[model samples]
Target: MFIKIIKRTMTIILIIIGLLVISYLLFTNFYPNFGGDIANEQKEVYQKSKQYKDGKFHNTKPVPKDLSFPETLKLAYTFFTTNVPNGRPKEDLKTKKVDSINIANYQGEARMFWFGHSSFLLQMDSKTILLDPMLGKVAAPHPLLGANRFNKEFPLAIEKLPAIDAVIFSHDHYDHLDYGTILKIKDKTKHFYVPLGLGTHLKKWGVHPDKITELDWWQNTVLDGLNLICTPAQHFSGRKFNTSQSTLWCSWVIKSKTENIYFSGDSGYATHFKEIGEQYGPFDLALMECGQYNQMWSDIHMMPEETAQAGLDVKAKKIMPIHWAGFKLALHAWTDPINRVQAKAQELNITLITPKLGEEIIVKDTTNNYPKWWEKY
Candidate 1:
């Protein structure tokens, strides 16, 4: 009877393990949010890239990403359990509604509308382009798996957004490349410019292959007099468990007839900033990454001071902080990024623009002093 009881216990354990394995397989395979799998043909193409190695892509300079078992446990524990004061807002952040009619009929100079975080609606030289437009409420594979947006509404609903001339993606991180937002805007989007290997995600999500242009670092494509160049950024990418660094990541340089802009997608403090500035310096405006960072991952994300210095390294005439004011992805205070970066920018004498979410930011208008919007809370 004792022998039989041991056998029953073993059988129950196996059954539970089998169920968990089945659930994981089904979830990963059926879930569209996990993004595309690398095909054999895609692998052959990836292997040709200088950044590609035995099985994955590498940064221009190697970044140490591995944490020890104990470090991993401690990191996870802090991430899951730490109670951060002001990690999120006391109230929903204020916002202004974006009008579609204004977008269609604007005869103004090059302008931008921020949708919070790294998303931007850029209207320049009669073209409408979206930069990392992850305009969803949650920044995770599933809505239930993440926090909701701090502000209840965006400047414009994704469904009501104007027809897009182009979409630019720096990488495939869920916070930057949202599946739901792509599904809604892909039909209206004319072309997509992404780093090498990133088009795989778009194709799987139903974006036409011809509509997607995959570019390597320093490679460029032109659209109606607008030049879009995929530049280098020190970062990594993945949307699912097994796909980390399976795709290339990048920053972008945009040149119109009268305006030059640089968008730093996400990056650590590195020499790539200096290199990019040498190659494409003196940008009229630059959107710099300024949030979701910690020393544990110092090689992948910049601290506030590094952010300010990066703007100078990129030769930006003026800078604006992004990658914040949208999600509470780190333990820092929600306003910490802006507050810290603002101090550094002032010290460095780098003119930084702090625009309210949904406010119109004109490229050449240096006199309009943006209200310190986050201080009210």
Candidate 2:
């Protein structure tokens, strides 16, 4: 009887394991096209890149990509079990709805609209540009794996957006390169600018090949009246477990005849910031990353203090802290990034702009002030 009982337990265990394997396969492979196919031509182009080697891309500076299996397990365990008090707000955060008509009619003035987190609408030189527009409810492959966005509604839906002159991507991470959001807005966008190997993802998602332009680090392109240069960032990328570092990540430099702007995609404190400043210093404005960071992954994401310093390193006349106030991708309090960066910016005498989500920030206007909207929550 004991032998029979052991046999039954083993059978059930095997059945459960089989079911789990099947579920994972369906989740990753069958749900939808995760991204564009890496075609032979694309692979040949990647092989020519200095950063590509051994079937993957590498950062210019040495950076660790993965933690040990045990450490990853511990992270997952803590993430689910910990009581992250300020990880999310009790009530929905406040936001403004941008007037689409005003945006369409504007001419020659450089302006920006923050749509929470890293996504922004940058109108410069009479052209409308979008940066990492993950305007979706969730920032994961599926809603099951990630929390919904902090705000219940986006300031402007894709249907309501004016014809975008260009859409720029920093990397292939879901938060920065969402699949659903791309599908919805591809028809309305005229062109897409992405780091090396990321155009494949866009191509897979139905963006016309002619409309996509891929650039390596330090490569510049002239679109309309703006000069865009792809710059370096210390980060890794992959949508699935097996494809890590297959795509390059980068920051961006947007220079117009009147203004120079820097967008730090996502990066740790590195000497590249200084190099970029020397090459294109005295930026009129800098959008720096300042959230979702922890000591465990310090080599990839910058701390708040580092964010302030990076702004200075790039010789930015004014700085705005991004990558926070939208999602809880870390263990720290939701308000911690902004609070700490604000203090550090004050100490460093960096001119910081903390705009509320959806608030308009005129690039040339220095006197406009934004309320500390997160304090009430």
Candidate 3:
């Protein structure tokens, strides 16, 4: 009996070692399998851009917030240990027929289609843009990890996608950007707009030098009639270690000839929202981050009330909450964020638009007569 037990222990240890070796090999080999030397150079340039004339790359007074380490760990434990199942209503979760977006209809104007979980297709005049497009089954690289994606099917697959003028990425976090989705739509995309050094990840995935454009905070890029401005957000970035904050993370301001829209990419409560509003707000619509929130990372992700206040700070005419209802990124009930945001918006006299997955919401004239869509979940 002792000999058999010893043999079993050795076998188990050998199996564990083999798995680790295989995991490392796969990650090193194919993880960043797209970009090459040019991509690395771009990353260096992005790093250099962060420094201000005063010599410090980060010059602004750091925004103060509560991000206690112990609180964060407790939040993580609650999310993992708790078996609470959070998701949209089963009936509402089903994908309705969504036709392809028409750029001609939105010519010289701004329009957006939410594809669930921080992904949106924005059209400004003739320019077609996709923001943090994640058309994958899982947010994490390995299917076994990360939460399942909210919308299982996209209105249009990457291969079937229309000619995309540009793809704007918020950060390198898995939920915000998926490698598999990028691989599929890489060829369809004409240009890539990302914060700081994120191009490294894209180039590693196969994007070319001329196609990638990395920007720093407050930097602006002109695409057709639309101006894509990279604004500051309270968040960090990295797909692996030795790379955290190597790339800048930011929200975006999409301004066209007639309208301006703020995409609050992903951020927690910060006075910067008010600053952003004063600088480039009074927007027609604000797509603020409003999901996957907890006390641990409250400094990085805003709670529902904070999200509603962000809209007011930005002086936005209407608010549509994103970053929730698609994945269980936090411990809150699946419908908690939306439900909270909805009540808060009503109390503040702010118009809230609750769209279905793949629903098209016209910012200029959002029709709110639709039934309480989230209640069905």
Model 3, TM vs. native: 0.84
Q: Which pairs of residues have clashing backbones in candidate 2?
A: 36-204
lDDT of each: 0.90, 0.89, 0.76
User: Where is model 2 poorest over a 10-residue stretch in terms of lDDT?
Assistant: 30-39
Which candidate wins on lDDT?
A: 1
Please give each candidate's TM-score.
Answer: 0.95, 0.95, 0.84
Tell me which of candidates 1 and 3 scores higher on TM-score.
1
Q: Is candidate 1 or candidate 3 better by lDDT?
A: 1
Clash count of each predicted structure: 0, 1, 11
**Native-structure RMSD, model 2:** 1.9
> Residue 193, candidate 3: how far off, in angstroms?
0.8
Residues 1-377 of candidate 3 have per-residue lDDT tens digits of: 99999999999999999998888766755755322222444444544564322212232444323346687577567767887655434643655445555443456446677788898888776778899997777766577866676666765556666778999999888788887888888898899999877787887788896999888888998887679899988877655533445566789998887888999988878887998999997899999899888786677899999999999998899999999867777777778898899899989989888877666677687567656666666
lDDT, candidate 1, 1-377, per-residue tens: 99999999999999999998899778878998887888878889878788888778889888857566688779978987999999988888888888998997786789999999999999998999999999888999999989897888888888898789999999998889999999999999999999989899899999999999999888898998899999988899887667788899999999988999999999998998898899988898899999999888888888989999999999999999999999988889999999999999999999999998899999877764888878777
Off by over 4 Å in 1: 1-15, 67-74
